[model samples]
Target: MSDFWLDLGFRANPYAVRALAPTADGRRLLVGRDDELAALTKRVRNSDLHPVLEGQNGVGKTSLVAVAAYVMSQDFKEGRSQQLFLPLGEPLQMKDDGSELIRDVYFAIAQAFIAHHDDLRAAGRRVPRVDDLETWLNAPTYRSSKGGGVSTPLGGGYATTGTGLNTGSAFTDSGFQTMLRRALQEAFPGNSGGFVGTLDNLELLDTSSSARRVLEEIRDPVLQLPGLRWVLCGARGIARSLANTPRLNGVLADPVDLLPVERRYIESLIDARVHVFSVDESGRANTPVNADGFGYIYDVSNENLRDTFGYAQDFALDHDPAFFLDSSPAEIENSLMAWVDNLAEKSARDVRLQGRMWRLLEDLATAGGTAAPGDHDAYGFNDRTHMRKNVVELERFDLAISSRDEVDGRRRSISLTSKGWLVHFAKKRDLLGQGALDLSMTNESPEV
Candidate 1:
C-alpha cells in the first residue's frame, strides 16, 4: 500500500474519505467553506445557545465544525479572540440512554483537558478538578501512586475507593457532576469560554421524537453545563426538529442548513487536496483523477464530497494506476463516464419497477431533484396514494428518501439519492440513449 501511493507521488491517498481534522493541514485542505467557517465561528463566539446544523449526509458537516473550532482555538490562543474555545478532539456520538450520554460528555471533557493540559496551563487556565478527572482517565494507559479520600455520596454515605491511583472513586455520576462543575467554573470563569464540543448524527436515534426526549432529559445536566459550547448536527430534518422542541427552547440555536459546495469550487477542492497530500519535492503529484474527472464524480454524488472521494479512490484502486497516469485527458474522461454509467446500470437493474416508474424518476430529477410528497400532480402522479406507493418503492431501492414535518403534518420533503443522480446524469448526457447503461429492466435506484 505504501509503495502504491508512493509511486503515485503521494505520501498517502489524497482522496480518502474522512472528516477533515482540527489541525493546520485539515484547515489548509478545507476549501470553499469560508462563509460557513466564519458564520460558525461568529455563532459560537456570540451565542449562548448551541448551534444546530442540518445538512444532507456526507455534506462536510463534521469537517466544517472541526475547522471552525480549530480556527477559534488558534484565534484565542494568539490573542485574536477574547473568548478561549478549545475544540474537543471529535464529535461525541449521541446515545440512547441519558445517563450514558452525560457520562460521555464528561469523559470527552476529561480527555480534552488531558490532551491540552500544557496549553491550558500556559494560558493560566489551570483546572485542578479537571486535572484530577484527567488523571483518572489516564489510568489504563499508566498508573501513579497518587491517592485521595473518598468523595461523599449524594445519598449521604461514603463513596467507593481504590486506595491508590483509583479509577472508580471519582467516576461516579455525582462525582463527575461535582468535579465538572468545579472544572467549568475554574476554567471558564463565568462564560469566558469553554471546550467547543459537538454531538453528531441525531438522526440515527431512529426517530426525531427519541432525539428530542434524549436531549430534553439531559438538557439541565448537559446542555446547561457551564464552560461548554456545543454544535449538534443531524441530517433529514432531524436538527430542525430538535430546534423546534418546545421543551428545549432557547437551548438550541437556529439550524444551520448546509448545502452542497457550490459547483464553481469543486475543482479547487480537488486541486487543494492534491497539493496538500503531495509527497514529491517539486510538488508534482500523480493524481489519478483531475479536476474535471472529480466534477463528474461530484455530480454523480450530488455534490457530496465524501461520496466523490470514495468513488475516486475506489476507481484508482480497482484498475491499474498507469491508466490514469499514462492516459490522455480524453481517455480518462471516457473511462470515468463508462465506469459510472456501468455502476448506474447495475443499480438500475436492482430497482424493481414494472410500470411507468421510469417516467416518475425522470420527472423527479427534472423538478430539481426534490419535491414535497403532496405535490404528486407535479411529479406526474394521478393521486397522492399512487405517488406514495412509488415513493416507498423508490426508497426501498435506495433511490429516494423522504422527511416529514411533524408540527404541520402536511409538509414533507423527498429528494433523489446519489444513485438516482447517476441515472439522471445518464439520461441528461445521452449515456442512456447511447446504450452505455441498460436501464430497460428498472427505472432508477436510490439510497434511503
Candidate 2:
C-alpha cells in the first residue's frame, strides 16, 4: 500500500486543539466574526469608549480580540494609524479591599506594554523605550497591611520604598494621567492615536464585588482620557448583570455578541482541515476519511465550531491512516458515544456538586429532554434556587440550553443538548447499569 497519509499536506494533526485555521499572509486567522471586527475597529478608531464582547465559552471571543490587534498592528506598520494594542491577559480575581484588583490591572497593562515593545524590537523595528515610562511602570505602587508588608510592584520588579505611589488611591490622580499621556507619546513617536487595551475573560469580575467596583471606576474616568479605548470580553451573563450599574450606563457602548458560526461555515471548516489530508496519487483530491459521517457529527455537535472540530478529530483518530481508509457509520456512532461518555466523566470530575448535576440531567432526560421551570420540585430540587444554580452549572458545561418564552406567562424552558441526552441515557443503560425510565408522558404536568 502507498503512503497515503504521507502524500497529504499537514505536518501534524490539523484538528488539534491548538491548531488555528490558516489565514492569508500578514492577516489574522479569525473565522465568523467579521461584523464584530468591523465594529471593534470603528469603535477603537472613532470614539473613546469601552466595548464589551459577550459570548459563550469556546465561542471565539479571545480570537476576535487577537484579530483586532493584528489588524491594528498592520495599520500601524503601514502608517495608516498609530493605535497600540495592549492585551491584558486575564481578568483579576475579586478582592475584598479592591486594592489588589486595581494594582493587578495596572501591573498587567504595564507588562503588556513591555511585551509589545519586545515584539517590535524582535521584528527589527526601531522603537526606543522611554525612561519615564519604564520608571513609572517598574515602581512599586502599594503596600499591604500584612506583617510581611507585601508590596505591589509594576512589571514584576520591586521598587524603592519611599518612591512608590499608593495604587489604592492613585488611579484618579492627575499626575498619573499626565505621566501616562507623555509615556504614550514617547512610546509611539509618530502615532497620534492612543492605545487600545483589551481585557479578555471579563466575566471573572462578575462574581466579585471588588473587581466590579474597580471596573466601574476604571470605565468612567479612563475612557474620558484622550485616545484610550477599553474592550472587555466576557459571557452574556456578565453583560446582563452589569446592565443596570448606574456608573456604567452611558460609559460602555452596547456589547458585541459573538454568535456561533453558520452551519455551512462550520462544515467548510471541517472540510478545510480534512482536505489537507485528502489528496490522491494522481494529484486529484478525494473526500477525506468518512465524509458521509460529517452530517451526523455536525448534528451531535449542535453546529458549535469547537465541538465540530473535536468530533472531526475523534473521527480522524479512529480511522488511522495505515489501517482504515474511512470510518463506517457504526464506527462513527461508537466514536461519538465514546466522546459523550468522556465528556460526562470529565464533567463529573470537575463539578464539585456532581451528585446534584447528575440528578438534574437525569430529571431532564426523564422529561423528554425538556423541562419547565415549574417542574423543579418534581425533580427533587429542594427549592427553585437550587434548581437555578444547577441550571447555571449545566449551562456552563454546555450540557443544557435554556430559553425564555411566554406560554400563558413568561417562563424559562430548559432542555438537554444532544450530548447531554446521550450521556444521560448511556449512563442509565451502560455506565451506571441503571434501567431506563419511561419518558413518553413527560410533557404532562407533574402533580405538586
| Clash number by candidate, in order | 4, 0
Could you say which candidate leads in TM-score?
1
The runs of at least 3 residues in candidate 2 whose Cα sits more than 4 Å from the true structure, single-residue gaps closed, are 1-9, 18-28, 79-98, 118-182, 185-191, 205-211, 220-228, 271-295, 314-321, 324-433, 436-448
How high is each candidate's TM-score? 0.85, 0.61
Residue 401 of model 2: what lDDT?
Answer: 74
Candidate 1 wrongly placed segments (more than 4 Å) = 129-135, 138-148, 151-174, 371-386, 403-413, 426-448
Worst 10 residues of 2 by lDDT: 433-442
* lDDT (C-alpha, whole model) for all candidates: 0.74, 0.52
Score residue 357 of candidate 1 by CA lDDT: 62
Query: Looking at candidate 1, what is the lDDT of residue 141?
Result: 29
